[model samples]
Target: MENYMMSGEGEKNSSDVVYLCDEVFDFSTVSSAFFILIFILSVTGNVLLLFVLAIYEDLKNITNLFILNLACSDLVFTVTLPFWAAYYLHHWIFGDFTCKFMTAAYFVGLYSSVILLTAMTVDRFITVVLHNWWSSPVRRRRYAMAACAAAWVISIAASVSDAIKVEVETSWNNLSTCEAPSDGPDIKLGYYLQVSLLFFLPFVIIVFCYSAILKTVLQATNRKRYRTVVVVLCIVAAFFICWGPYNVLLFVMSMYDPRGCNEIERLYIAHSICRILAFFHCCMNPVLYLLSQKLRTHLLQLLHCKCVRIKCKERGTATTVIQNVAFIAQNSAVTLDPHSK
Candidate 1:
């Protein structure tokens, strides 16, 4: 959890003395633990969701389809967590190839997740507000697929820009750090552009879509309007609550020059906390999606179906006996009727 600041050249400043407080904060320990927890829960939950979606034909709706892809992207990102955790723990042991790959995978997943969430919000908005102009299932499927593909393409391009500029340097303290080379202005420019495009733009889109959807729901005459409002509100609240601080911290760090800051150690501590909170976003969606009433009901029905099949196998003899008894009772009643005679 030690914070090491690099010069714009991507090299550790030899003249810069390591502060006493540097020994206290270990980002490796904190970030490693946080990523480990996120990796486990997000991978497990999203995988289970993917399995559920794949096995059940009826669950193949457009929303669920986008959700399935979202889970896949999350899972892919989560899979790279061990490398990061190792980096935090062993101080970037895997070398430059992995360094680039890890960073690329991370951004790719991050961007893809944002895009998917925005798409899901837009899909909901259309279904709720434009009921008359509904598109066919085929068109919806195509659009969802296209959105997913576009997210990946854009993410890859952003990641490559970072990868090309990023360098791994062993600091004076002998810790290996991966960061952008100092001489390149493109790196800083690229970083800022990424923040704007991947995070800020998508955030605005999500907020706008949800707002419109909320307004429409509020104006509806249906008794279920209140319930719909609550659902959309929960989504909006969660999105902001989990992501807002992280984005703020990123902006703060981007603006903060270690040379200018009076208390670098304090700022680093705050930044680390915000980063950990941001990681919470990875697993939050699965909780929201799985805990939703609609999704829960469907999951229950899926479980119930499995239970019924199991019971039928174990109690086949009892089932046969009950069927035979009913058949006999019906024949006996018909024989006694005068019309039957």
Candidate 2:
């Protein structure tokens, strides 16, 4: 009995001694710089998208409503990144509240993003495949708003779980780390489920939906086929390329943690790289959405109108030249009028 007790104590001591990687990269430099860049780009892009969707009366479609929510989610998520960047630099300097909030924001953004993407795909599918029943303007607007609300509720619940489970730990080196307890079985299970449901399942759905959409588009003979297919493919492919590795790496890390794994350093490095790729997703959506030909043309027309007004401030002569150029272009066969006649 004494021998067994002694062995148990020894095992406990071994487990209590936290092991950290020897060659952990000084990620502060790169992480800070990279996240700052992402924050600027994501905030600027998503906010501009939101503004465009809001102010542009012509863009007041159900699809734009969903996109507005998506941009809002991305904006909220990007706002939390600076905290993470600060953590990476100063080692989780924020208190427990911030830790919870920031972590929750991250997961919320993730869950919301996937849910919205899935919702968007389903919406498109219904509109395209069941146009008779699903394409009504009133019904589409109602459904899209409902879907957006449901996504927010689901994402909030998902993020709340993380807020509940996460705890801040201080290392011997005086660095505070936000993490779950080392032997937290419930937390581990929750983590696994969160990743699986929020990322893996949604990814499968997206792939399946996009594949079917592609097939359907190919079978049809619409003049808009090339543009529509390219846009959809770009969106789907960007999501897969940016987020896929992060999800895979997260699963691998979760698996390896419960079971003793070798080459910890390599896994850690891979995780860091995956995280960087994941961050790119926040900014990529705006570019994909805005770069669509329709949106670009609208933006250009707005800009040109604004430029014409601003140019009027320069001088009357320049204004007359501009008007004459416009008139001659409108009546291409006629020469520019020298006088009012």
Best by lDDT: 2
lDDT by residue (145-210, candidate 2, tens digit) is 889999999999988877776777786777786654534577667667777888888878877776
Candidates' RMSD to native: 5.6, 8.0
- 281-312 in candidate 1: lDDT tens per residue? 67776777765676666666766887988888
Clashes of each: 6, 0
Deviating ranges (above 4 Å) for candidate 2: 1-21, 57-59, 223-229, 257-262, 301-306, 313-341
Instruction: For model 2, name the residue pairs that clash.
Output: none
Q: How many clashes show up in model 2?
A: 0
Error of 1 at 59 (Å): 6.0
What's the lDDT for candidate 1?
A: 0.69
